[model samples]
Each structure stands twice: as structure tokens, then as C-alpha cells.
Target chain A: MKLTTTKRLERLNERYANGDISRRSFLTLTAAAAAATGLSMPWMGRALAAVSEVRFDGWGGVVQEAIDKYAFQPYTAKSKVKVVQGTFGDENEIITKIKTSKPGDFQIVHSSGVNYYIKYVNGGFNSEINEANIPNMANVLTAMIEPFRKITPKLSAVPYDYGTTGIAYNNKVISPEEAKEKGANLLTDTKYAGKIGGYADMTTRVWYAALQTKQDPNSIQDMDAVWAKVRETRDLAKKFWSSGAELMDLLSRNEIVVTDAWSGRVAALQQQGQPIGYLDPAGSYAWMEDMLVLKGSPMAECEELINFMLDPATSIAVAEGQNYPPSLDPTKVKLTDKIAALPAFDPTGSMKSLTFADPLYWAKNEDAWTKQWDRVSKGA
Target chain B: MTKGWKLYDQRLAWILVAPVLLLLILLLLLPIAMMTVYTFFTFVTAGVESAVLTFDNWKEFLTDSYYHGFLWKTVRVGAITAVICAILGYFPAYFIWATTFRHKWLLLLLLIVPFWISFTIRTFSWIHILGEQGLINVVLIRLGVISEPLPMLYTEGAVIMGLLHFLLPYMILNVYVSLESIDRTLIAAARSMGCTSAQAFREVTLPLSMPGLGAGLLLCFVLAAGSYVTPQLLGGSRDALFGNLIYDTIMGQLNWPMGATLSIVLFVLLGAAAAAYSRYMGLSQIMKGLSA
Candidate 1:
């Protein structure tokens, strides 16, 4: 029996050497052999126990602060899992890190909703979440959960926070009525050219254009027209901003009377006593930040962290502190009367009116948009 | 007759050059080689898939009119900025070098003062000086210069101004070195031959300083070509140059291969310019002129 087994093993090894067996199967066989040889011993367990660390990569600012206070500290205290934090500029940086660096370099990453959809869902960089392990996920609102479910049926991401793209105007320079009027007629009106500003991001710009034009953000398949409109708008635009700070600078300096801005950024500006007011006149595009477990992560602790973040109190604190709408059940947490009144976090609504950003659309049409924008901007 | 002396000199030369040569190969040549190879491949959207050998990225750049325009614009802007710097820098450099010892150090110190602050901070400071309600506009309006604020910050004029501000010193320093190295006797000889002061300066000083001017122009051009922050902050959306395009490709679009291709293109153009200058005007002579 031993001789027959040896011969069979030798034949299998020959097949593996000849590239018949895949690396996955080879790894499985190796693991089985290690188990058979008694190598899954006490030392391995002790070593793993000693190195109980989880790295969380995310964007900095209020979101990071909320994570530190509500999730990172509490989770570390309860589970003794050391949380190491790294900050990234945007999704591209995170993608670059994942592609170039070692696996599990960032076990968990906080990503924008569209980025999660494109990179995690469409690009297959994320693993399916085991919902049972994330008990606190039950607290997330149905409306917020619905979009992710519809878009990525695989449940690859856990929704974290949300914000809207809207017009932020300097109240001192532009009246509320003027701002609203401009917001209402932004797409069709060529009169306000050279005074308006917007983000440099193609996805955000496209969504804004669609909303202003009253086109269905999801249904409008042809982007060439959209690119043309955006290019026209760019010519009219005084500047294209890359960051929140730049927008604020433009507003403060009165270089721009009104501009498209993120809600959190506008809120931060308001807190700083800038005479800025944000309004979502034509129904703003909503982006849900998601915490996705990278593939090949140390899953157990990552799941624990996600569950911890999903808790109602934690979610509420993150939302209020970060100036972003939390994905958790709204009824369970107390919100400022002003925050509660915001359309995004309306507790009584069965469905929130939101234009979901599609990354696939952006990816497919980016080249065309870039070329058009280049032409328009250069006055070619 | 002197084998030991010859061996000693050879060893000394090798010892002196080895460290710098190794550093150059490691830091510059290796990265350029990798970038050259990467420019030919297409980066897969998914991380799981490996890059394949292809000419699609290069082909796209070659065929695309937008990128071609960007390339030409970059060269034009660089050339314009270099010329402006050369013109503006000549007088300051000559003035500083021509002055006596007492004023020379003070003038030199004044030239170097801007380098004390960070580049980003300096670039941002321009906004305060040139924005719609900024210092320049406000003062001008107060002085009844114009009824409305001038379009200053996000314009090509602002980009050129920022480039000039940043590169002016480099030109001055280079030209100064060249001016300082001229044989005082050459000027005396020209004057003794009955030439006017202006004529002697035009003939002798200017010709002797051509190498320095060329070197400074080349440096200014290359720096202006690769500059990102000043142009993005100061120029209009359409005014974004080649560097900005590379940034957009890499960071905005997540297309590394395209970014690599754009970078290689920039590198080749800049490298060719440098090589041509070095071939026509000796590199050592240029350096000597700069240091003069």
C-alpha cells in the first residue's frame, strides 16, 4: 500500500512539475502535507498570536477622527488587535498600493462609493463579506444598503458614510435666490460662463451635468454629448479645482461667486466662518464611502473592525463628527436638528432621491472626456 | 619610466569617480530604463492580470491630437519662458557681477532670499497678490486704475509670471558666473583699440557669455517644462501643460502605462535639447561660464 501511494504521489508531482496543476491546487496540497507532517503545531499558533496587527488605510480628516474615536480605539481595547493607520490622497493611491505592494499591506481600506464600485466590485479586488460575522451591519439603513445591493450583488463592500455634491456659494457675494437660480439653470444657461467653477474629476463633472440637464444619471448611455457639454462648461469656467481647500480659497478670494463642492468640504468651510452656503437644487449626486476588506487580508480581525464601525452609536458619531450621513439606522442615533432636516438623512423617507455615481461609465468615457476637455480648455 | 606613478594616478581617478558614477546609474539610469520598458505595455485595470507587451499606449499618444497639442504647447511655453528668463536675467547678473565688493554680497543675498520659503507656499502667495479681490487688484482699483478687477490669477500671464519668478534667479546666477570669468585685459584691449564702452561690451562681454546664457536657457526651459504646481494653481484649466497631463493620466485616470509614455516623451525631448546644446556648446565651457 505504501509503495503504491509513493508511486501515485510521484506521478502527481511529475504532473505539477509539468505545469498540469495550478498554483492554487499546489498550495492546497502543500498545506495538506504540512498538516499530515504535524507542522501545524503549537509554535505557529504562538507566532500568529504574537503578531496580532491590522492595518487600516483611509483618507484623513473627520472620517479618520471618527474611526480613531469610535472604531479603532474601542476595537483595539476589546479584541487586543493593534490597529495601524495609513492615509491616502484618493482611490488611485489605494489602487496603486494594492497593485504594487505586498498583500495585506492594508487589510482594510476606506474608499469612496464609486471607487468601491469600480475597483472593488468591477475590478475584483475585494472579497465577499460574511454578514453573520458583521452583526452591527444590521443597523445600516435599508435605503443606503439598497444601492450597494443593486450595484454589487456580491456584497463586496460595507457602506460607511455618504455626502452629496452641490453648489457652495459665498453668501456675501451671491444671494440665496441667485445661487438657486444658477443651480437650476446651470446646464442650459451660457450667461453664467467664466463665473462658475467645478471639480476636475470627470465622474463628478458628468453627474453634475446630467443632473442639471435633467437626464437620468444611470440611463444616459452616450457620453460623447456629455463630454461636449462639459467642455463647453469648462471654457466658461474660471478654474477647475482639485481639492476642497482650493475651492474654499477661490470662494474666500471671491474669484468664484458659486461653485460645485462636496457637502463635507462646504460644511468645514462654514465652520471656519466662511460666508458659504451649500444647496442641492437639482438633486445632488450622492457618494457612499465604503470599508472594503482587501483580498488576502487577515479576515477575522478585518470583519471585527467592520462590525465595530457598523454599530449605531459609532455610525452616528462618525456622521455627526465627519459631517457625512451615516449608513446606520437613523432612528437609533440622535442627530442635530439641522442635520436631521438635511434631505440625505431624512428619517421618514422610504427612498432618498440620489444620483448614484457609476465608475464604469467614467472609465469607459474618460478618454473621450479628457480629449474634449483638453480641446475646450486649450481653445483648439 | 614611471609605472608606479601611472598606477597611482589611475587609482586616484577611479576612486574619485566611482561613487558618483554608481549613484547616477542607480538613481537615474535604472529608473529611466524601467520607465522606458513600462511605456510600451498596457496596465490592466484589474490587479490580478499582468501587463502585456504592446504598442497601443505609444500609438495612442502618437495618433491623439490632444496629446500632440499638449506636447507642442509645453515646448512653446518652455521656450518662451526660457527666452524671457534670458532677457530679464542678463541685466541683473551683469549688474551684480560688475558692482564692487561692498555691494556684491548684498545683491547676491537679495537674489537668494526667495529660496528661504517653501515652493508651494510661495506659489500660493501669488494668489493673495493677484486674485480678484487680492492686493494687486484692490490697490489698482483704489488708485482708479480700472473699474473692475482684471482677470489675473487663472491666466497664461499668471503662469508665465510664476515661472519667471521661480527661474529668474537661476538665470542671473549663471550669467553672473560667465560675466565674472572674462579676462579684464580683453575689455582694456578693445577700449585701447578706440572702441566705445558700449561697443566693447557688446562685442567682447556678450560673446564670451553666450555659453552661460545657453546653459541658463536650457535649465530654465527644462524646469518650466516639468513644473506642475505653479501652472495648475495659476493657469486656467486649458493651460494645464504636459506635466499636468501626466499627473491626470496617472492619478486621475489610474492609467500608469499612459503616464509612463507621456513621461518618456517629456524625458526624450528634454534630453535631446540638452544633448544638442552640449554638442554645439561644450558642457564644460557652459559650466565655467555659469561659475564665473
Candidate 2:
């Protein structure tokens, strides 16, 4: 029920447009409101200072390009506030940069969801967001918001989009039938030795390994079997791509014929007429991405920006362009055909069909597993 | 008045040197001291650490064989690269020194051309040349060579090749400066005193250029050993150098304390190499080559 300053101002404007007050009264009230807010707090001067630009860091690829084209550009045009952007191939790389930087140096992040949310929370880099500012949050799937809410009841981030990390194969070498039948096992197939690739990430590697070993990723047992399966895939892989762009490069150049690839990136490749076939095998790793406003950000402006991004038209356009489904509840807001057809799109809006990594379960094992996986990927 | 002027000259000399000395302390020594302190800090979780001083990070580094293996491999790779650079770079340095061709500076200009392009782009160019559907494979398959595309990229060899590409010019420049400084009369004297061309070259030219070659070797070795990008781009996971390990520890693992420990190890090892070079070959020769 806490209203953002923007929402309060918006209501004032609405009343004014409806002739609820005289011109002098409206002007007097506006000035009084501004003075009260600005002079009320010692630190409010910096916080309420006109934010001309919002600094945003994100994954630099087609995904970010879509966000820029569909959301950021339009918002900037409407609001006249520029969005300064930076990119990181890996989330942890940006985390390190943020650690070395001062509080307000970085503002918003296109963060990988709850799994990374824990890291931010632990690092004390999280900021409480006033949800009433983002009215569009009403349309976002409750299932997507729950995970983040579970970590911090007062959410610091809003789930924006979701996708699957599934098996992408070159259709020229692998038939759709073969890909469907083999599923996650295709990554470890000896036939594709020296032509195989995988994501060089702990969660993705361990998740696939869990699937291959017939263990649930959320409650993985038989750690040895999981490690063995991971090693099996590692020994056969030609390379372990670390970024989405690198994944596309390897696949397009045929440096790798089979690999675990992001569904959105594979969809992009298909759109470009690449002979790529994508499938979300049973227990494929699913993840959600969020717009995380970090500590010491321009809160009202960032909340307003998040609100703008979540507008159904903008969200849907970004989803279609990025080939990821919007976190907008499909049952609430109508979606385009392109979004429904996009990989990992769930019509029911329950999100139960996709097997997202349990934030608590994964966060608990991240440090140990990540260290072990790093060594394993390096021929340990 | 003359004595006072002499005293003023000494103060002027100190004033001229103070800025550089202060810069070195601030930029180099202070950061190293901070990292050394961080090496003792406890790593609680990824991206979270405590200032509670402990010897655990250093203890782990010293006790672990995994770190040692990577460090040794990095040194070995660096040594191999230096030796190869010395062999491949000598003739080019000798060519520029011995050439009577007009526009000698143009040859040196060719060496400087690669710097105009981005180092990352130069490394990425190898992908098109070495990938499966790349130029090498297409041409070889067309000409009825072995059917399979040679697995040339992302190997240790590719990494070494990338390093060589980057560091070769340094080697050539260093050796060239050494060769240029050689007195032509010394070689002429040896040649005139019943020595053949090859013998004169070995006795006079090669020995005189040793300081430059030695300097180049040390420079190439340090740069190659400390390389992070080339191996990350061109080498397979197993082919990662100590620098990559440090990167993984700090950035990937978010274990900055251990990363700091690894960094200090590399710094100390490289510093030792420089000290050893200074002991055997006067460090001033390296200075002369670099200045020229």
C-alpha cells in the first residue's frame, strides 16, 4: 500500500486534469509538496535530485538488444531520461566490478533471478522496492515473484522474463527425432566427441548432469554420479562457451554441433535461418531474469523505469524480440502469437511446467559446487 | 654564490625524481600491499569476505598441489614461448640490421602495424582461420587434403600461437635495438682478420646482441606467463594459465583472498626473474634497448 512518489504525483495530476482544484491551488500544492519532500530529510537532497540518467548493466547480446530496442529506447523517448548501459558476459564478473565500485556507481542490473538474488542479499547490495510504483506488477505471474519474495519479503527486484537452458543441436547433423530421443544424453554422446559444447557454468553443468544421472536437480543425490556424468560430458566437449554470443558463434560456425544452449539464443539462431533445433528435455534447467535495482540507486526513477518496462506492450515486444516469454501472467494479459510460440512460454502462467532451480536449494550448494565445477571443467 | 647554486642543483634533481617515485609508490606498491593484506582476509562466501585476519588463504595456496601444477605449467609454457620467440625473431632482427635496402625504417614500421588493431580482434581472427567451417578446413577439403578439419583452434598450441603473435614484435624490437648498437667496425675487423662471415657473426654479432635477446626473453616470458586473455580465448579449459586461474578464483569463484594470494605468487616469481636477469646481464642494456 506504500505509494511511490511518482504515483502520488500521478494522482495529483489526474485530480488536476479533472478540475479538482484551481490553477493557483494546484501550483501552490505542487510547490509545497516539492518543498516538503526535498527539505524534510538531510540526505533527501541527493536522493531527490533530478536523475537525468539511470545506469544499467546487463548481459550483452540479443537479449539486451531487444530490451534496448523495445523497452529502454521507448521509455527514454517518453520520459526524456537517458539509460546509460554497460555489459558483462558473466554475472559474477559484474558482481566483482560492483564490489570494487561505490554504492551508486552502478544502479540497475539485468540480474539472473533468485539464485543470484541470494548473493546480492548476502552482500548487502539489495534495496527495498515500493511495489505500488510498479502497478504493472499486478499482471506479472505470482509464481515468478514468489521465489524472490521468499528471499526478501519486500522485493528488491521484479522478475522480467524467463527461459530454459536446453539442448541445441545442428539439424544438419542431428535430426529432430534424434534430438528428441537423445535429449540431455546427446551432450555426452561419444559420436560427437570433439564437436560437442556446453555452458561453462556450475548450475547449468550440474543441472544437466543431474538430469542425465536420473536425479532431481532441486534435490540432487548421489553426488559422485553427478560428478561422473559432468566429467563424461567435459571429456567429450570441444569447448565450453561462457556467453550467449560465444554460443551462437560456435553453433553458427559449426565449431560445436551439439551443446546445452539458452532457448532464447537458439530461437534467435532459428530466426536468422540457422539450421538449429532446440528442445527442452525432461528436467532441463529453467531460470528467470529480473531487473534488480541495487543499493543506493535513484529509487523513484528506477521504480518508474521498472513500471515502464513491465507495461504489457513493451514487455511483450521485448519478449518476442528476445525470444523469451515475458513474466506477465498470460491468464491476465493477452499475449501475441510470437510470444506464445517462443521457447519456454507457459500458457497456464503457473510456471510449473518449467523446472526452475529452487533458489534455497541451489544457493546452499552454489559455493562448493561452483568451485568443484570450475576444476572439473578444467580437466580436473 | 657558486656553492649555493650547486646545493640548489641537488634540490632540483630531487624535485624532478620525486613525482615518479611518488607515482610508483601509489600505483604499484600500495595496491600490492593492499592485495597482500587481502590474502589474509577470510572468504566467507562468494562476493562476501571478512577483514578478520587469518592465514587460511596462504596456507591453502602453499598446501595445494593444484595451484602448484598450474603455476609450473604457466612457467613451462612461458619458457617455451620465449625460446621460440628468440629462434623465430632473431633472423628478422638480423635482416633489419644487415639489410642495405632503402627505407630501412619502413621495415620497422611494418612491425608496429599490428598494434594499430585491437589485441582481442587479432586473437579472434584466428577463429575464422582455424574453425571447422573456417578457411583452413574449406581450402584443405577442396584440395583433397585430409577430410576432417584440423582441430587447430582452442588448443594449447593455438594459445601459444596467439602469445607468439602478440609478443613477437617485442622480441624483434629488443633484438633490433641491440643489433643497431653493435659497432660495424668490430664485425669488419673480425672479418678482415681471416674470419669467415658466419664465424664473424657468431664471434661478434651474436655475442654483442645477447643482452638485447636476454632482455627480450625476460619481457616475453613475463608477458606470456601473466597472459589472461589469449588462453581464455584460444586455449581449452585445461590449457588455462595461472592468470586465468587467478581470474577464475577472483571473478568466477569470487574467492578474492585466494586470488590475492595467487597474484602475489605470480608477482614475486616474475620479480625474481627480473632480479635474476639484472644479476647476470646489466639491466641498463634492457633500458637502452627499450629507449631506442
> lDDT score, residue B239, model 2?
94
Candidate 2, pairs of clashing residues = none
The docking category that best describes candidate 2 is: medium
Question: Candidate 1, residues B86-198: lDDT per residue as tens digits?
Answer: 99999999888777778678888888899998888888888888888889999999999999888898887899889999999888888888877789899999999998999
TM-score of chain B of each: 0.94, 0.97
At residue A32, candidate 1 shows an lDDT of 69
- Model 1 pairs in collision: A194-A236, B177-B292
Per-residue CA lDDT of model 1 for A1-380, tens digit only, reads: 45553454455444432334543454466456556764453223332344378888887766687678877888889889889998875576677777677655666888787545565655556666666667888777676667667766757678787778888877886688877777735533565566778887766777766765667676676666666667667777888876656777777767776778878778877878989888887567777788877765656567777888877766766676667777766565555665674535656434456655655665565556654554555555
Where does candidate 1 chain A have its weakest 10-residue lDDT segment?
A: A41-50
- Which stretches of candidate 2 lie above 4 Å from their native place? A1-48, B1-3, B7-10
How well does chain A score by TM in each candidate? 0.79, 0.89
- Residue B178, candidate 2: alpha-carbon lDDT: 94
Query: In angstroms, what RMSD does candidate 1 have relative to the true structure?
Result: 5.7
